[model samples]
Target: MRALIRFLFLLAVVAALVLAGAYYFAGRAAGPQIEIHRPTRLLGRTGTLDVSIQAPGGRFNDVTVALTQQGRTVPILQLLNPDAGGAPPDPRTKLTQETGDRIRVTHPLDRQTLPGLREGAAVITVTAGRPVLFGLRTTASSADRRVEVRLTPPKVSILSTHHYINHGGSEMVVYRVDPPGAESGVRVGQLQYPGYPATGAGVQADPTVKVAFFALLYDQDLNTPIELFARDEAGNQSRASFDYRVFPKAFRKSRIDVDTRFMERVIPEIADHTPELSVSTASADELLKAYLVVNGDLRRKNAAFIREQARTTVPEILWAGAFAQLGNSQVESGFADYRTYYFDGREIDRQVHLGFDLAVTANVPIVAANAGRVVFADYLGIYGNSVIIDHGMGVQSLYGHLSSIGVKPQQNVANGREIGKSGMTGLAGGDHLHFTMLVDGQMVSPVEWWDPHWIEDRVLRKLREARSRPS
Candidate 1:
């Protein structure tokens, strides 16, 4: 009887050990994990749903993903495989996968896929299986998340009808958009001119409506399409087109001769500032290269910085009439001039001069061209000592290569107020001011801004007309 009892006890202990081992392997097995990337918060009516699927050790035998909103379950994708999708065997499906580690899922989500999905939270559940019972069975789902869906787009309309856009100048547009919090702007090519809350002048800026001053640089294609765009938090987008009157004009072209003195002064300055020039000991060829770098590479970077500074502007009309020009000054160079540099009688480089070069007495007073809040008053590369004044509604003026600056950032200056003095500090052949007018950071013709007639007929007339209309 005792021997039989010992035999029974040993058999029971062995059975328990087998069960413990099976449980241990099952514990290591993990369910599918989902990382939702897109529709981050509010899903758009017509947008994409991006997610990443991951399995720790083995592949999933079965995978299922579904979206549940208002008691409705919409299936996204399902795959039945023994190997938790270590390597993807199929294309067309975006499942970022590395053999045996993780997988991803990125699919389009819109009204077509998720019927009746409205502006609210929706639950996303993912279930994945990994063989744990000696490669015999799989585990259950381990991921569940929520996504916000927004299917409605913001309403937008143009208030200013008459828009005068010089082929390479700036203009202002006043428009209204519903849902005061929605983002609205004008899109030209890849660049977007943002909308700001209008303020200043006698006119009150409405929260839903704003006036944006934007630019048309000479570099941009004259025929490039433009549109006014608005979008809400839900990624719903709307667009509107306005009647635009384009004025075309020819730009000046000139060949500038490079002198020895000019090269020596500019090249050393370039090498001192730009580490990429790679000319510890300046040679003729290296000096030319440095000059090109400063003209081409550095020029573009400085322009981008200026654009960033001009992005934030007041909404109200600041200036009263035409912008002021420097007194007793002569036009040394014209705006939108196509310039070619000749070195040793050979054409070395070419660039488009975006600003008018005004020759004035050395260290003469540099005044504000119009009444505006000083947005940027600092040293800018290539332009040297520069000051940018924001004339509200995305309209701004750039005064470059100044000898001295008398104003600080955020300070308000009236038209003809002395802000600085002219100088030959940056890439300038002589003491002069590089004056340019910009709309949304795009260079435009300054001639129109200087003419009171143009302001009344092209810009202010439309604003007056818009305000006179019934609410």
Candidate 2:
């Protein structure tokens, strides 16, 4: 019995030795290893920084990282239980065979955390570890990473006209440049335009390039010294300054000679289509009376309508120069003959001249000044075969005494498209095209619609730039 017991004890000791050797080798294999990659050593103080790290085989927890500049450490980030409200205390920083393990961590530097560390070299340190696992203590590890932050001059340029008066409203200026290559992988911070209302500045990507920038506007008067600034990924900044002067907004005025007789003839037709009048007459005297009595009212009503139809939103194509001609001197004798009369320019002794006279030659194609739906395309009164297009917004265009009508009523016509041929159709004297523009049934100057630059600078640009200055 004593000999059997001795053999069993020897076997037990051998088994214990094999198990201890296996554990020792495993612990050695799990030695703590850490790697830190500082891809971009030079960073813009206000821009973004990207850091990468690699740790083998161990889970990283409670990692606290900071950027150090001039002996002061600025906490970049701390990885902790998000539920804990704050980062946990650092673990012991010793590596041992029994507790050695591997871990990895990465961090992104942005504007908020790198405020004071601009224009200097920065050191990044990471502390990582976890609590005891199965009653075995583990050692925490740290790695030192270095990066250089530099301040770069900004690129600033004037987006608006080089010279502008204090119009006292928002003026848009676009400033842009290519973003840092590192920012290509992620969304960069919002671009802000200083010295302007917060709502007025916004960041947008350039349509033609990978660069992004802010479109900022100065909505208030530049009475004081104004500075323009831009910021980049590493928080680098650039700025420029310009002086502003208060000057009267520029405007131009010119007088256009209008033939009142020609205007009077078309007044009745325009008024007949107006919704406000509700009643109209074919008599020339009666029409003239309505025009004189309600001329102001008609202008107000029609101005609203005509402005709506004006091609003021964008630029318009204009016909250059004016073609002058004479028309028939007598009215058409028959209803089928398309007879119309021209009254003399004077209000008194309005003599009837035979035929409608246009300023263009016979068969000259007439173009519609604006886009609209055609409402009339037939012969009536003294107008031979006439065409009327109702361009919505209370404006209408009439091409009268035409030799031929290319469009029918209810047909859609685009701006500057040929709609009819000019002719002396109604009365018999000479051949010319009678063109007219009507607003709310009253004839204003047709010259305004034919001038592209005038409409843009005067009507469109001025309105867009106007500041609500109290009179």
Candidate 3:
């Protein structure tokens, strides 16, 4: 009886050991997790494929990625354990990073990288595995993504001629893009001015025809390269050079004297209104420091805000005639005036005055420069109590230093309509109106828009000529 009992106990112990071994080797049924972040829907002619892999306890041993199309497989990346001796990896496979338990891979999917690649539906397969069952077997996971390949670039060409742009002025370009929905524009050096449909500009032309109002900003070099560019959704791009000329112009330079009283009035008010500047207004020295910050940093912020407002303009032309200048007003400061600031007979700072400062009388009524919708009506930094009106097609007018605004945002006003009352609410020495014209967010010479002949020759004639031509 004792021998029989001993045999039963040993048999039970052996059975438990076998079960424990099996559980330790094949406990986890799930494979490594694979993630492909790029090439989700469409694959352009040239793009990067980003992939990540994670294993149980970060213990990946093998990973493979490939692109499959039309019964052909192109290997992108493959990583295997050196101990698991196999054939060498393909020369094209590039492994970016490999940690103890995770792996990252990045490969370029381009014509030069992958030859014989055609435009069609393709599948990217990512497989990852980790050692299981004591290195005898592998637990693997896979993910497949289907994407469409696009290789052809969008076509772009100029449709209108006589594209003359002044160094500090604005010009309009009429062009055509093969794909109407493609984003087309005028590229002046690094600055991009977006194009709108010609129909919106009152031109009964083809849908693919676009009109863009671009500028040769005052700061840009006189010989900056200008060209028309078009880009499609798949990242395909093309450019075309048009016949254009750049005329050089000279700007005025002047000196501005700052007084203690002006600092106390302007600096304190601007600092109080602009808390983001984080400037101290407790003492005279601090007030001077705050003044510098407002004039430089706050001024740039205000200009960026105005540019953002220009983005929401309507596509069609809203104004009918030349922009109207303030009546019975004297131009105190001209556009692009390089002003040097002096306090106590010492040079303090210098900045370019972008707008024309006009003064008629204290608290004079300010009117709309043209027929357009008021896009912004509020207190802007440095400009103080300003209003910006959109005249459509990337053209806008700004009226600053207003004591009170009568029109609200989105309110349409006719030409010469009174919109506000001018005052010294902002950084103004006396009650006046700061007016300027913006072309595609660039502050250009408003003098061009104010002249009827310049408008007739530069803008109106281009539209009429483009409309006369067929698609």
For candidate 1, the C-alpha RMSD (Å) to the true structure equals: 3.5
- Best of the candidates, lDDT: 3
Candidate 2: lDDT of 294? 38
Name the candidate that leads on TM-score. 3
TM-score of each: 0.87, 0.31, 0.89
Model 1 lDDT-worst window of ten: 84-93
RMSD of each: 3.5, 20.8, 3.9
What does the lDDT come to for candidate 1? 0.77
**CA deviation > 4 Å runs, candidate 1:** 1-16, 19-21, 24-33, 53-63, 79-93, 97-104, 116-121, 128-134, 198-206, 273-281
Judge candidate 3 against the unseen true structure and give its global Cα lDDT, from 0 to 1.
0.86
**In model 3, what are the clashing residue pairs, if there are any?**
58-101
lDDT score at residue 462, model 3, on the 0-100 scale: 89
lDDT of each: 0.77, 0.45, 0.86
User: Which of candidates 2 and 3 is the stronger one according to TM-score?
Assistant: 3
lDDT of model 2 at position 93: 21
lDDT for position 395 in model 2: 41
Write candidate 2's Cα lDDT for 1-471 as tens digits.
889999999999998887676555544443234455443556664433333322343344456677788899888666653223333333322222222233233344556656676666777776654433432443466777677776665465333323333222112232233332212211112323222211122223232112111111122233433445555555556654543333432212222222346545455555544546643445666765564433445435433543344322111112122211223323222111121223353433222121123454557777775676776777533455677677543345666667788998778777667887777654223465655554333333344345575345433342233222121
